[model samples]
Target: MSQPEELLDESLRAITERTVELANPGSGRAVAALRRLTARRRTPALPVVVVGEVSRGKSTLVNALVGQRVLPADRTVTTSTWTLIKHGPSLAGQATVQCGDGTIETVPVNTVAALGTYLAVDGQQQLEDLHGAGARCVSMVLEVPSPLLESGLQLIDTPGVGGLRATHRQATLTALAEADAVVFVIRPGEPISASERLFLAEASEQIGTCVVVQTHRDQTLKAKAALDADLASLTDRQQWCALLGDQERADRVVAYFRDVKGISVSSRNALLAQDEPPGPVRDTLLRSSGLQMLTEVLQHDVVAARRRVRQRTELQLVELVLRQTRDRTRETVALLSGDAEAARILEDRRATIGRWVAHGGDLWRRRYRAGCARIPDELQVIVDRRCAELNTDVGRQLAAMKPTEIEKAMKGVLGLPAQVFTELLTEVDTKIAAAAAGVRELLERDGLAQQAHQTDDDGVTFERLGDGTFTRASTNLSVEDLKHATLGGMAGVGIASSGALVLAHAGILPGALAAAAAAGTAGGAAGTGLAATAATIAAPIFWPFVVGAVAFVAIHQVSRVRARTREQARTVLATVREEIAGTALTRALDAAKEVGRMVEEDIEAGIRELHDEADRARRDLADATTLTPAARLARISDAEDLLARVEDLRAEAAALAGRI
Candidate 1:
């Protein structure tokens, strides 16, 4: 290899090695991701892609590389899909061509004419088959014996640009993704168009290394001069015109192969004629030296191919590993800090709560007797007034509602007064909740003060502190609180109901008559003896006490179950969180680390192998120096200039690395 190529190989080795180091597991995944991206960018194949406005000899160039004129070169657009061609060989001396998807097929030298049909390029309908197959199937491989070509180098032929129209632009763009380098072909007479410009803008950066091939060598000078004249006419952009070259009617076709490099080649037909018998055309074609020039271009790029592939692949892996690790870490942090778990835990606590309600008839009867004796007359006066007001309001409402109107209104109305009842219950619930809250606050304060007296199994002495000093351990209420409170509330309601019932009965009956009847009943009961009479009157209280006892028992049972459930919930939650933290999260993190390690190792190994291969290539290039005189001259003319360019590339690469 030349000194420039060696330097390039060295720089590539350094980059790959650095990438591997950065990709180490348990370290910076972001750095690894960057390495993978760099590796992808430095892929070995300097892809030579064929791009043009429709019908611009892209497929023809693909065929020429294989030394077989098999590509569809019809008047109509014969090539519809993006077709990739790679190097391959057959048992016969003739070239072998394999379609995409690794299906090998061979064509004899004589059978080259049949390729249009072989590729299904008869018409739009035939081309549709290839288009529908997608890029993978549409691609094919062709091998030719040319020392200038490198291993694993591919030349992609794209769909005719204008023929595909806007409808198929996406497919064209997708095909562009596979190209490592590009060859843009433009026909004579067409202006640099809007669509073409757009394609150039989008693809120029992606296909970083590009060459423009203006086909039909006979018209080369005319095309060049015309393009130059057009560009020069724009006084605003004269530099571009001068850079493109303004010479008219030259013998060679020109190509701006790089950012600041340009080359010219003679007609391909004349060069092919040289291998045939000597003729008048042979001398002229030989002087043009088109074959020799093209060969050098291909060879020069071939040397850099392997390095590019390694660089690109490593970069991709680095990026993937880094992104995955970062995402996993973020997810773990969220799981640990988020409120969702707390909400779930609270819901489980709610499931442990139990409810009970009861009112004893015995307690109600005692309260009923006392209330009746104390307030019978006062209750009678209030009831009479309330009844009078209700009757007047009902009469007025009835008068307002005519018989016909009443029937109509009654269709939608009910005696329940759903709206009013709902509001009334809501108000009652609010007041009860407020009262309960106040009671709880008072109880909590009292309980804190009484904590010194409360004793557990340890029997440790303690002193009550202020409310603020009480911790959650002591502030929690037990099932006993709910049971006692529920029972007390039921007893109060029973007493109030009993008082109302007694007062209502007094208003309905004459007080004097009732008293006389009660006295007579007592006399009768005395004749039967006080024991029998007492038993008869005690039945109501006896049944009330029995009901109260049953209610109390049920409440106790429910409270115990709720308390047990709460305890179980607390235990289960603790175990679940522990298992998740210890096992699931731990395993996930371990797996992530393992994946990172694998990627790091892969990148390291790849870098080492690439470095070794580059060294071997250097030795091989030195040992097998069999270039022709023309090849030697071509190399001398381009090598130093190319080295200078490659040096700049190294510097650029360094700058990019520094930024990273």
Candidate 2:
């Protein structure tokens, strides 16, 4: 490293260490960003994306540049996903598949051609079927042992957009958006398409540099000239205005694209000449291929541009850390003097936040209550519909069933209420999540209210709680318990059997009330006796009139029993809705209250910290007053040393900024 690089490294290390020592709550994100910046400084790479229409020689150019046939090239739209090529100790390849649920899977591959298996439509379909809907092939990674990749140059080969689907165009555009620089390859015989021209115009706005390459120079020189003329016309402001349909932007874009440098290269000749000894024939082949000029342009333009971007990013991060440190130092200095004005401002701010805490709690409660008020009615509608549907279906079945079959069919309908309760529970969960989100939004808004005070003031602000904290309270109920409760409640109503007496004894419901409700809903003892008699009426032993009377009585009693059961089930559901809604609202309010308490506690902690700082300042003042002359001189010397260190860091930052 040179003097400037060494100086920058030292300054960044100091900033990172100082941030760690300060350990301010708000500094966590800043510290993490600084660490990443420091790591990037250690191993910086310039990302260059190779893009073009199908069969435009993008992959061929990349293979020639790397001096290895690592990327597969063909006449068709061969590349299907973005492939990042980098330097490794040895050749390696991997494919990264992103599933619909935001999970990533890495599949190792043995050859570059094998990558197509993952990127192809058939492969994607298989993956989708395996991973379920919305799964896709995201991107691929390839590592090669190449000299160009070793010197901090990363080349990305992208899918061709020409003659392909609109999705391919979108994927290419997305790649271009993140590229540091772009290489647009064109064939000699074809003029730039409308899509390519539009893409170039958009790339001009997003990327720092773009270089055009005219491939297949082995073709007629006249064809190359024609392509060059076409490109020159495309860059003209008037043509761009016609192509892009924006006057002011056309002017800007034309200026950017006008001076874009283009080089002609035959990748075929370049690849063949790589193994030949130096001679006139070799020189001629390399010159005609234009590989030498391309290398020089990449080194001078693309590499330098990347360096500038990296330096600027590093400078920004350093300045952020410096500003934070200075702010903290200023606060300490104020505390050292035990400033009465500072104490009064802090107290006033604390009082303001306390008022917000109280008011916000009440506001959140009102909003939560109002949001939950509609849930019961919504649940009632669902329950009523489900119940009516069950009744109609059961009534039709009863009309057709013989006497012996009636009891068996009616048992199935008894379990229908469990399904309704389950659906209602799902709806309740959805509402609770919504209510929790509302409460969270309210808390966040109040949290940001302190930002205005922070601009002209210096004190700790409340950190907003995480999402899990707000949602946990409302989601405490277990689905299994709900399922069991619904089933148990249905079984107690005697729709299936005389087992209702057993459920009553087991105290699933209050004993006498359970017995009475079950018996009444089951059409009383008379109804049960009629059903028993009807079961035997089908036997040959029963007389004809007796069988007829039993059948009539059994049908009538079954109807009466079903009607009573329907009304009782509706009443039970209504009660369940009230209980569940009440529980959800109570949990929501408790969560809101917890948030308010946290805010109040955070403010109180800030007040205590300020008081402690003031106390330390008082002690320091006393010590200074009691210091001997020799001790005072020593203190002055220490202060001078710190001042010199500060000046040195400031000059280093300025020099780094100039480099950026």
Candidate 3:
């Protein structure tokens, strides 16, 4: 069977070539989009990146999947670089390291022990031999003969987060995270911790789908108890996902992650089964390890996820081109037939989109700007109200707690800010939803965008957040660390230090807390795609929150505020609130305004695309109307045939996406 990408490529080339033959100037943008889409580099194999917090049995899980101890699975040895495993003809003993200077070096490995030693990421000294080729190692590839891998599964073992150095956390994770499916390995206890939640949130936003594996099933003799525990934790994740603006991601999280009970696997037990003789006992251990179910689920998700990514990324261009060509062809048919009334239908349709663009753009722009202007102040109100509540909530704990415990109480009591930011998120999501629906009403009503094309790819616009690069918004930090940690850290684009992540790929969960705690600096939002069409934007919210959290802790611990009385703590917090509100929150407000402007720009750009389509139809119809009656009839014949071809291509694009 042809992959969706192959089919899309074939269809796109046909449609684009035919469109070029017609010499349609209006199809230029759509044609160019396809050219750029097809010209980009393609992945040879589907990358299934295995990621998790440190010591969560990620390496062990990879070992069990491949039925070998090729990687160092000892928790003590931190696997720093990525171990990119692909299918090989034989169980070859060799290691290839891609250096930072764009050079690749291969070394012969004598034994499994030698592979482990050469690839170990424990200490700088341990990797000296491996690092001798270059100043930095990009990734290490190990080829192993496995039936599962032979099926085009490229398993990558990355260093776990949480325990990684601050210098390397978010940047490395973001780069390594561009995978078809993320095998998120977790230990038995924490279905997820705080840092792990942040990482998973980022993963869900970036990749859209992942297969979560609960490792170390052998450690617990769980009959139904373990399943229940895992289910409860995942239930919370479902609720959180429901809150995001990308309803598709939320729906997928439910569909993909709904049955995780069977996905629990024990790598140790699976490895032990491999050591056992081929007998009933060994088979029982293998079944008990749950490795079969894990692999099955992983494979199912792998096949399904690649298609989704393809649809969202490149295949979208094919669909868009088909829509543009189809719409234009329809108008051409009517224009050539010389049926003034039939052609009027398209003219009126173009006029509708035109009216929406002219009238709706200003209306939505005003509303969008108003909402954007209101949000910062609303966020400030959320801050002030939540802080007042925090002052009250922490006071009760303060009466019973000692001065030393005040720091702990302050940090814990500030849960109010999280709630406040969550409210802000809800408001932002509402406005974004409203913005998307505002223009879509006309598109859906008239069937101009064909209603089918209204999905995220062609006609849809404005997910709640966009992934834009951010500038520093906070001022109270060292230049080196705070630079990357601002809005993306707050909730803009980049992966922040692993505190809290809220990504539509624009994160506010971490940054909102930073704004609340340290009186946030400016945060940013952008569309990384064409008008940020492909993905949502929200900067990270990690580092600023970390800085703010620490700053809040410091502010709360002043000697006068450390007094036994609850009132003194309240007084100090009151002072801190004023300071944060006047300085940081105002900056946060400015950042939010910037986000609002970007949201308007993206939404308005999408609206303009529709208008441009109508405008092209108008021009084509005008040109055709001027032709002689004999010439017009001849043009009608060509136009009808062109329409038929576009319809076939459109159906193919639809069929490919329907399964995806």
TM-score top scorer: 3
After TM-score superposition, the amount by which residue 312's alpha carbon in candidate 3 deviates from its true location, in angstroms, is: 16
lDDT by residue (tens digit), candidate 3, 1-660: 568667765654565455445434444433433343333225446667787776778888888888888887773444345566767876565454333243444556545776665455322233343454222232356778887887677787866653222222453353333345567777766556544554554454344356667788888876246655755665554564544333444554454456433367888889999999999989999999989888777666665445554344344445545555655465456556555654555555565556657756674466545544556566767667766665666655677877667665655443333334335444543454344344344343444322111122222121111122111111111111221221121122222222111111121122333222111111222222311221111122121221122222333345333344457556655555554544345444544454444445545544555566556656776887798888888777787777777777667655654655
Q: Candidate 1: misplaced stretches above 4 Å? A: 1-46, 91-114, 118-120, 123-137, 145-152, 162-164, 167-169, 220-223, 227-276, 286-291, 301-660
- Per-residue accuracy of model 2 over 245-271 as CA lDDT, tens digit each: 447557767776776788888898888
Q: Candidates ranked by TM-score, best first? A: 3, 2, 1
Give me the displacement of residue 483 in model 3, in angstroms. Answer: 34
What TM-score does each of the candidates earn? 0.36, 0.41, 0.47
The deviation in Å at residue 543 for candidate 3 is 12
Q: Which candidate's lDDT is highest?
A: 2
**What does candidate 2 score on TM?**
0.41
Q: Residue 393 CA error for candidate 1 (Å)?
A: 99
